[model samples]
Structures are given as C-alpha cells and as structure tokens.
Target: MKRGLMIASALALCTAGCGGGASGTAAAAPVPAPTPAPAPSPSPTPTPTPIASYTPAAAAIPTAGIALPLGKCVNMGNHLEAPNEGDWGRAIAEDDFTIIKAAGFTSIRLPVRFSGHAAMAAPFTIDAAFMTRVRHVVDLATAAGLNVIIDMHNYDELMAAPDANAVRFAGLWKQIAATFAAAPATVWFELINEPNTNLTNAKLPAIIAPALAEIRATNPTRPVIIGGEGWSGIGSLATLPMPADPNVVPTFHYYDPFAFTHQGATWVTPTPPLGRVFGGAADIAEIDRNLQTVRDYIARTGRVPFVGEYGANDVAGVPVSERINYYGTITAAYASVGVQSCAWAYTNTFRLRDGDHWIPGMLAAIHTTTTLR
Candidate 1:
C-alpha cells in the first residue's frame, strides 16, 4: 500500500533578509539644496500586485524535446518505497540493473517514499544517509545504461492536507532537485507518484506549480514527469494541468477493468471480486477503449504520454495464462499508442519473479523480444 507522512502546518513561518538605509542631520546636504524642493510629499506606498495563479492553456503546452525510449520498462517497486531497504522483502542489488538491461528494459522507475526519510519540520531536510543510498542505486541503473526515474511515492499526507503541506512538499522537491542537479540527462524526476485526495483536478495546479518552479530552478532542462489527478488514472488525463515546460512528460497509470487487474487484492478498498479474467474479445475491446482515451488526450494536447505503472496482482487468483495474455495485450496497446510504460514491479506483490527466478511466462509476456529464461 502507498504510505505517507503527516506534515505539520507552516502558518507561522517568517522570512529574513538584508536591507540598507541612510540618514542625515540638518546641514549635511546644504550644497544640493540651493533650489530647495517643496517638502517632498511622502511617496505613496506601492501596492503589492497579487501574484497571478497559473492557468494551463493548450497554447502553453510545448513540444516534448526529450525522448524516453518507450520500449520495455519495469518498476523497481517495494524497494526504496518501503520504510527501509529490505523491509519490503526485496533489497535492490546492483546486479538487478544488469538483469533489467539484459532483459531488454530501457528504463526503470524507482518509486521512493521520501517522507519516511525526511524531517517533519520546516526545511524538511531529507536524510543524508537515505540520499546516499538512492544515489548508489541510481548510479547502478545509469551504469547499466538504463534511464532511471526517481519519483516521490506514497505521500498521502500531502494529498490529504494539500493546503497545509504545500510548503513541505515544495521543500522536499527543492532538496531533491538540487541534490540531482548534476545528474545525467538519463536521470529523470517524476514530481509525485499519484496525486489524489484533496489534491484533485481543481486543486492540483496550485500544489504542483511551486514544485515545478522549484525543480526548474535547478534542473532546467531535465525530463520531468507529471501525472493527472485521481491516482493518475487515464480518465483524468484530459483534466490534468500541463506545465509550460517542454521537457515535461505527462503520465497515467493503467489497471483498467479494475476487476481483472486488482482481483482479490486486499489493499484495494472493498476488494475487487476474484475470478475476473482477460483475453476474450470483449475484454480486448474494453482495454482498447481505455487506451484510446489516453491516445486521444495525447493527440489533443500534443504531449507524449507515459504509462507510469501497469500490472495485475499475481495473487488476484486469475489464471496465470490469462495474466500473461493481459500483460501482452496491454503492452501492445501501449506500443500502438506510442506511450511508454513500466510494469508494476521487479519483486514483491504483483512481481515478475518467483523467488530468485524469473517467472518464464510473465517475463515473455512483458518482453516480447526475449523467450522465457
């Protein structure tokens, strides 16, 4: 399940800075006062202009300049996103990158729950030790020639109390952006994992605007990913506020026909009914309809889409054959629409592995180029 940190209010904050002033007694400037000007009227205090809120417009959406290979990508989930390394039952090993690359994946999305390793107070400093560990993992992926996407994951606190946590949320990105300022272009930043709760379509722009500005200040041209409201669901794609930056890539998650993908998944509220299956003609048509929603959005906005997360839970009790078919069909659908994607996980629940070995059928379903190993 996605986790979050409870952030404190920042209402009492104050800013400090430098100022200069000058004063003089009666006789100080006698030379220049020959034609003494009438008593200078007090300069009217300048009225402060209220900052204009950002309104996303279609004309403002720039062409995406950065190209992320849309080919096979996988999520290194349940690792860094956990409370600690190995706590989620899978500690990422350096060799994992090698395996990912060798298996034909061109990128890996690293979901990190930064709130767990950050200060709860102002400045919200991320734990240095945690950052070091993240850097090491990033280095591993980059060295293996796989593009790495670092994302803020499971920040439920920010979602629930967006107004109060705005400062801390921006602070978190400010630190993250600065920390990865010098990272290679292959290293990408995803603003946040999934924006839900009070951070809905209507309120998303206010929260993300400052965060995007914070990131742009440091890594100006880096490829940053932004998702829509409602857990980044495809239905919300049209309503997502697109930033003016050309390097930004819009993303959405796909677990369409939720009953089929999340069947028997306990984490999902009112748990999805089990025994749901995929691969029939009707199922394929329904999947196509969902993919078309994304395709239409991309065409309308001219912003490339990235399917950030997609997968079926292994324990959903659907037959392995149906799961394989689902993965293959969805992967093809994504390819058809020219959208990039990363499967749900490398290990843990909804994983592609059973213990240390690759689940042959699952691997083949994801990477069509390779056979079962």
Candidate 2:
C-alpha cells in the first residue's frame, strides 16, 4: 500500500418538514392551500445478494500449510500499482525478478491497481490488455523461481464506497481467480492492499466475504491473504475479522515508530521531519513488543500472520546505517517469532537496489535468517 493519502468527505443530508393548518381556523382565514405530503422516506438500499455456496472441485483443493512459506519477500511496488506503470519513475524489468531471486528473496508482492484498468459498470471487466500485462509480469517472476503475491492494490473507489463497489470488487476477483486457476501454487492472492477510508474494520467482513467466496469457486484451498483496516497496521489485528475458511491467511503491514520509519515521508500529512534515527535499545525493544502482539494474536486465535509490508524510507538526513539497522531488526524480529515478511519495496523511496546491484549492505541486513525463538 503506497502511502499517498486521500481522505473522503462525509455525505451531507437535508430534510424538510410539512406544514398543516389547525382544524379550527380563524373566520377570516381562506381555504388553506393543501399541504404537500412529505416525500416518502427514500427506501434504504438493499444489501447486495450474497454469492451462492459452492464446493471446490475436489481435484482443485490444495493441502494445508500452503500459505505459510512466504519467507524473506520483497514488494515490487510503485509500478503496476501506480495509476499507470512507469508513472512513478520505475517500471518492471524482466531482470528485476532475477536480481531479487539472486539477492535471496523468496517471494515478491506485486501490487496492482486493477480498479483503474477495469470497466466502472457491472461485470467490471478488467481491460484484456492490462490483464495480460499483469500475467506476463507474474509469469516472469514465477519463472525466476520467486513466489508471487498478486495483490489488488490502490482501489481507492472501493475504499471510499464499499457498498457501491462491492459487486465490482467481487467481479474483479471472479475474473482473476478464473485466469489463474491453473497456475502453479507459487502464485498467491492478496485480497486488498491496506484497506482504509469508509471500509472500516466492522464493514470489512461484508466487503471481503463475497470476494473470498468467488475466489474459492475456482482456486479452492489456494491461499488468500486478508489484512485489517487502518492501513493494516499491527494494532488493526485486534479488530480484523477472520473468515471461517481455513485457507485465508491474516496479514498486516508495519512501519511502526513512524517518527523513525517515515521521518521524511512527504505523502504523510504534517510530514514527519527528517533527521530521525533508529536502532537504539529502546527502538529494538519496541520492535519486539510490537511483534509480540502478533505472536500473542496467533496464540489466541490459532491463525498465523504475514507481514505484507515493512520498511524505512532512505530519506535525506536519515542515515543509511539507521535504515539498514531498521530493516535488519524488523526482519529478524518477525523471524524470531515465526512470521514471514515482505519489505515495502525494491526501489523508489525505500529502495533496496542501486540500479543493477543491491544497495551495499541493505540486502545482507534484511535477508538475515533467524530460527523461530
């Protein structure tokens, strides 16, 4: 979930009261004009029809534990998720996958703004060309021996108006599931990236349930990742609704101690100033406490968590060393408790690359592997 912010305004309501004359009118009063009847209260919008229950073709169901192998992943961000690829100054290159695999990453999270490329009306057909383009990229990554997380990202309209867009959301997934139904299990589906705005914690179940139902129709038992609202921070886990389906994996994003991780992030309002430093003992302790929350949640609920995104921006004034320490500490912290994580990006603000090569120590820091404590 790229952090550019957009807040939606609340809809305004207006009401009018009907006026009537008293039965005992003054003698001088002429026939009072007939009072207009108050307009019938507008009918409440009916809830959308839920999808019919469907059993997976037995052959299509996968065995358990398929969603947990997401070790040492990195996000391929600011590319397809942008309103248009290359609009954010980085475009996916075939070799980029090769580089990531070589750098010791096990998977890649590819965020896509499908809403921008799909028809706005019923069926919400994704543009054929765009769909093919996404497949081409995913195929390239999987071919490079990297598991790919195909995420539905940047669906701002759906976030702002979940009820109005719920059908289109399901339609998009129906098409996506059918397209990848036969692909290797290495390809995964992430329901929506960092859901926010009107899609509150309470409202998320209604929005995601239909999409999951549609996905199971074709990709039964394949892992589907779901994250909580409020930008999917760790705390959101407390309120996130876990669907009854066994294959759904709970996910969350972390960029905690925001004063340190997002020190100079321009997209954040009242942007945190530059010059923040991390890796003090307290910082590391804070990281542990945060991750402990995830561990506790897993223990309490029996659902494993995936760190869908985490990183510190390499902004000016924030030392490169501090950024590296943040990555290493965060990565190792999650690993310490048996959770898998994907760094925020490969390039752009929080880049892990310098042109064709890994940025000096960045890879070594984030790629540190630790046995679960």
Candidate 3:
C-alpha cells in the first residue's frame, strides 16, 4: 500500500521497511490458483465467548478457527516505527493501548523497526536496553489482557544486501527470540516481518531457524508465525516452508489488485491501476480470491491461511461508507471461511479514525459478534 502522494483521508500514515521507508508492502503475486473453487468461511460461534483478559497456556500449533480464544488483533501502529516513536522504536503510550482494547480488538501486532537505532549492529541486532523498553510495553499490553504479536518488522533491508547484514538480521532474531523465550502465550513471535520471493523455503529456515530455534529452545510450545516470500504477500503464501510444529501457522498479507489498493504508491511499479472504493463486491471479490488461496493451500497442504495484515488507509477522501463496507466485507469473508485474521493497524497510520472514544463508523467493520467469534 505505498502511494506516491499521501491521499487526504482523515487518517495519518504507516511503517513498512526501514529508512528505505517505501510504501508499505503490496501483496506479493499469489501462487496460481489450482482450479477456481467456491470460497469457504468457517462459520464458527464459540459456545461461550472467549473471555476478556483470558490467558491460555501456549501451544505449539493453535486450533485452526475463531473458537480458539483469539478475539481480534489490531496493530499498535506508530509507537514502534513511525516518526512519533523514533528512538530505539520501543515506546508505547498507555492511552494508545487502552484505545485498542476498548475498540474490541483482543490482540495487538507490535511491529518494530530496530535498525533505525544507531546502536544496532550490521545485521541489525536490537540493543539490549532497547529490548527492556520493548518488554515493558509488552507487559502493559498483556496486563491489559491483550494478545501480542511481536514482529521483527523490517530486517530484509540488510537481508537483501550482502555480508554482515544478513548475518546480523539472522542474529537479531536469535537475540530477540532468546529474550522472549519466557514470555507468556499471549506474546507470540511473528518471525521476520514480510520477506521477498528471493527468500525461498529452502533458504528461509536457514535464516529463520536460528531465531525460531532460539525460541523453541526456551518455549517449544509457543506458536510462531512465519510469512511467505514475495514480500510475504498472500500470493507467495503457497510457497511457505511452514514449520514442522503444528503450533506454527502460515501467514501472509492481503492486498489484492495492488494497482487499485495502492493507487499512488511510488515503491511499486506501474503504480496502482484501477481505483476502487473499499467494501461490498470488491470485498467479496477480495475474499473470493483470498479463499481460493486458502482452499487451494488447504487442498494442497492441509495448512490454514491467516491474514497477518489487511486494511484500507483513509486516504483521498475515501468515504467512511467505503471503509465500513470494506471492513464489513473483510469481516464476513474471514468469518465465513473461519480464517483467523489480524487486521492492518490501529494508530496514526492506517488507524481506526478515532472520534474520541468512538472509532469512525467506516472503520467499525465489526458490526457483529460473528466477525470475531
């Protein structure tokens, strides 16, 4: 979703790679669909609603649907990498965390770009003291009864480069994983943020293993999320080298027809082509394509697909109706398929368009309990 010029929606901004600060990732090309098939929705309703502030013991592989207890997870947004939280990228305002939990989101995806800190080494290992700051915020979120997905935000900048950079990136994960080995189940590891196609499954574990192994060594049962190549785009999901452990889930970002969704993005080639408002048929169309990938993946590998990131930015006078429809379509799509999703973010960038305690109606896609059950 990188745009050449910022669109003037009521919302603010985002965080993708590094100082390279390109438009956030466009979904990498999806692997070819096997045979177009009808889309599927899981249609699950918990016998008892997942309790708020409930913590479950960490499991190696999570149960595949909404029944497992993960309500809805949104991003902590700017506090980690946006200009507002620049130093060490470790700060989190208590108010921000409260806003998220209050909004009905049960989890927070904390993406941090540690490389910005001068203290980082070549492979971009996060500094120790900075990690303490990270742990502190994590404590705040978990204490608030929210699940946390600690992402290694952006490391491929060094990874795509040669020598010490790759080593540093690999080592950075090891350091992080080792540090949080004892973290609660609510705090899961989302290995390296989004990777490019160049990182084939064959080569993935090599870079991922060192870090994953570090975590497994300490907490073998904790679920760890891993994304596919093609900048970890949904299309690239089919090629994922999902970890052997059942607790592992294959993850990818969903931004279809990037040309449309990322209309003005400069980092992307051919920029975004068609211009479509958020929601309805486009939502259905988007979900259709998504479930095709999910069913296709399930048919082929029996593994489930989850959206690590998916949402529309409030740019270019994008209507609240459009946002609401878009999110509604998304919620229905995921609910029907039984896909467990973590929507885009909740912050200054691509945020929920807060109107005091109320998030904008357009962003309030979750109009029903079914959306998160």
Q: Write the per-residue lDDT of candidate 1 for residues 1-373, one digit (tens) a residue.
A: 1112111111111000000001000000001111223332222233322221211112212244444554678888678876677765668986899988887788889988788899999899999999999989999999999889998876768867888988898999999999899988889999887666567778878888898899999998888888766567776676888777778888777766565665554443334456666655566666667767765776687776767777776762456776777677677666655565678778765677777777778877763212110
Tell me how candidate 2 scores on lDDT.
0.69
Q: Where is the poorest 10-residue window by lDDT in model 2?
A: 13-22
Off-target runs (Cα >4 Å) in candidate 3 are: 1-69, 82-91, 118-125, 162-166, 264-275, 278-283, 355-357, 367-373
lDDT (10s digit) by residue, model 3, range 132-246: 7788888888887888888876554544542445566656666677777777887887777666424555578767766676677767777788876655665665567876777
Q: Rank the candidates by TM-score, best first.
A: 2, 1, 3
Number of the predicted model whose TM-score against the real structure is largest: 2
TM-score per model over all chains: 0.79, 0.81, 0.74
Listed per model in order, the count of residue pairs whose N, CA or C atoms clash below 3 Å is 0, 0, 24
Q: In terms of lDDT, which candidate is strongest?
A: 2
Off by over 4 Å in 1: 1-67, 367-373
Model 3 whole-model lDDT (C-alpha atoms): 0.55
